[model samples]
Target: MTEPAAAPARPLRRDVAAALLVLVVWLVPISEGAIQAAPAAWWPTIVRDLGSISCLFRHRPESVSYYFVQVLRSGRREWEAIDERALFPMEPFGYRSRFDRFMERFGHRSDAARLDLARWLAARDRELDPARSPVVAVRFLAGAQRIDRARPPAGRWHKPDPGAAPVRVLSSHDLRESDRKDMSEETGKSR
Candidate 1:
């Protein structure tokens, strides 16, 4: 029998092309993250879009630093820690971290963002356990770790200072109807 007509060259070419395409698709996010790490003024539009797209693929904890929500029940001096993950679950397809979303939407010091955060927390509290004490206030704490670039990357990480004061990002009291209206108006004006 004639040496089985050497496997069709066309199929081999197609397989190689498909492998390349898959590689490119996976590399897009990694490339974007690398570019973002060292931002430049001349980045092209495609690169910028890729950076946003990369959020769906990678979690940049460095960018997030540290953020937490503190919940104080009515008449309580001590605050309970509410984990960000409990509020926002990771999407199956997207790489967006809950902390990132929390910071973007409600981490700001503005009155509107605070009120919104408080309302959300109150609602969540009610949903979780109606018998629990009502949430009187919600506060956000944000802190950034100072990285030393000169140190070697591995084992050079520095934990956040235990004695360092946490930045109070947002604080809001139990919202009344009038306060809610004011917040709505403020939001409308800002938009």
Candidate 2:
């Protein structure tokens, strides 16, 4: 019986240098462009490059945190400048940041929502009586599907606060061509 030869170990310094070099090369364009177009677009590649550098160098690196902070700051500034030129806003980034902040500050809210949902589930536990609760039956109909639930008409769905003053709010949607004409005519009368 013959034993297979073990693979030779790669040079640690060379691997680290190579990894760092690769990371630098990869991040220069993506991070720079992402900061202007989408600040968050930098994150995926940044994390990947950072991880690669970390793996190739230290088993327990200390500079990882420093590098991350530096990169984040630079990327943030670049993104701020880039965002000024953006015509359309990126909503997901705002939502993600909001959720992150919420999670950080009110960690309890998530738990509360979870517990509330669980309590609701428990109240509607199926073991007691399967048919007592409302039944939901979904099927694909051929021509026209009937909607059973009661809902407000289109414009009513997005109403403002009830207690607030009843001033008509302008919305891009739900406004007719006649409505625009009326507004313009009213403006002309005031002028």
Candidate 3:
């Protein structure tokens, strides 16, 4: 009896191999996610290949309160939003991701950190803009606004009444007082 001829071996094309590699790279996170016991166990990843469901029927919608840094520049009576561009010069494109992350981590941790940040900001403002007044005081404030499901788009995002006060003051530092204390300590004198 004659034996059947063996088929010739073929090598995988470079493109095919690369495609397979890409697929595997994408699947690593997904495969690991499938075995997680809880939703939170799936480590937060930017890869949203499958999509995500947030604040759906699974979670009740609620008011969102956010923390922000408000600086009181010298000669200005009103406390306004900080000029992030002036503080973070490297981020010329406008979105200050570094500042945002720093702010998020700055939530009511230590008094020293808050004071240091305020002092640093004041110094930067002084060096950058010699013409304008530097930041004399820095306040870490919390603001809140609620979304009304029953209201129209115009009235959907409802802020507190004009007379309503802030939710709370997270932290505040007067740079002038800090500078005075530093100067006194440097001169070996107590304030």
Candidate 4:
């Protein structure tokens, strides 16, 4: 048992080598993730080649501590005026993993009050209901890549309900204000 434990450390000698080992063991595959996790360009190519994960050193726990508070300590909260930026922006899958781990660690020990709080949070999930949360509604509606409100064929005109916003007849995300103005001028209200 002692020999096996020592052998594992022997294979992970250098700082970079150890970092790669951790990533290989912990980094979930992108296809199995909600967000794409990729290595930053600054990460060692050799490490990336060995582990098949993002070579990003900035957020890799091997390069730094794994605690969120520690990351905040190392970054904005600690060095407030440095104007540093992340080498690789983190995404939702990593967050999911972190939250799952947190729940696993503490869910059992939580009191009735804590359990009730969790239930309340679940009831208020904005993703499942937009009307109850205007902020979530705005973010979701406004961030859509393209809204296809094109009239269904010429003869099948459908009247808009009074409650609905004016349906966009023809609008592309590529169009600028000037383009919209020009089109509005050329085609009147129909466009």
Best by lDDT: 3
Clashing pairs in 3: none
Off by over 4 Å in 1: 1-64, 91-96, 104-106, 152-165, 176-191
Per-residue CA lDDT of candidate 4, range 98-147, in tens? 33233333432344433343333333443445454211110000011122
lDDT of 3 by residue, 23-88 (tens): 654565455445441133343435433323333344444655455667898888888776665676
RMSD after Cα superposition, model 2: 25.3
Q: List the residue pairs that clash in candidate 1.
A: none
Indicate the worst ten consecutive residues by lDDT in candidate 4: 135-144
Each candidate's number of clashing pairs is 0, 1, 0, 2
Q: Candidate 2: which stretches are off by over 4 Å?
A: 38-191
Worst 10 residues of 2 by lDDT: 64-73
Residue 24 miss distance in model 3 (angstroms):
29
TM-score of each: 0.50, 0.16, 0.50, 0.17
Off by over 4 Å in 3: 1-65, 89-96, 144-167, 189-191
The model with the greater TM-score, 1 or 2, is 1
Better of 3 and 4 by lDDT: 3
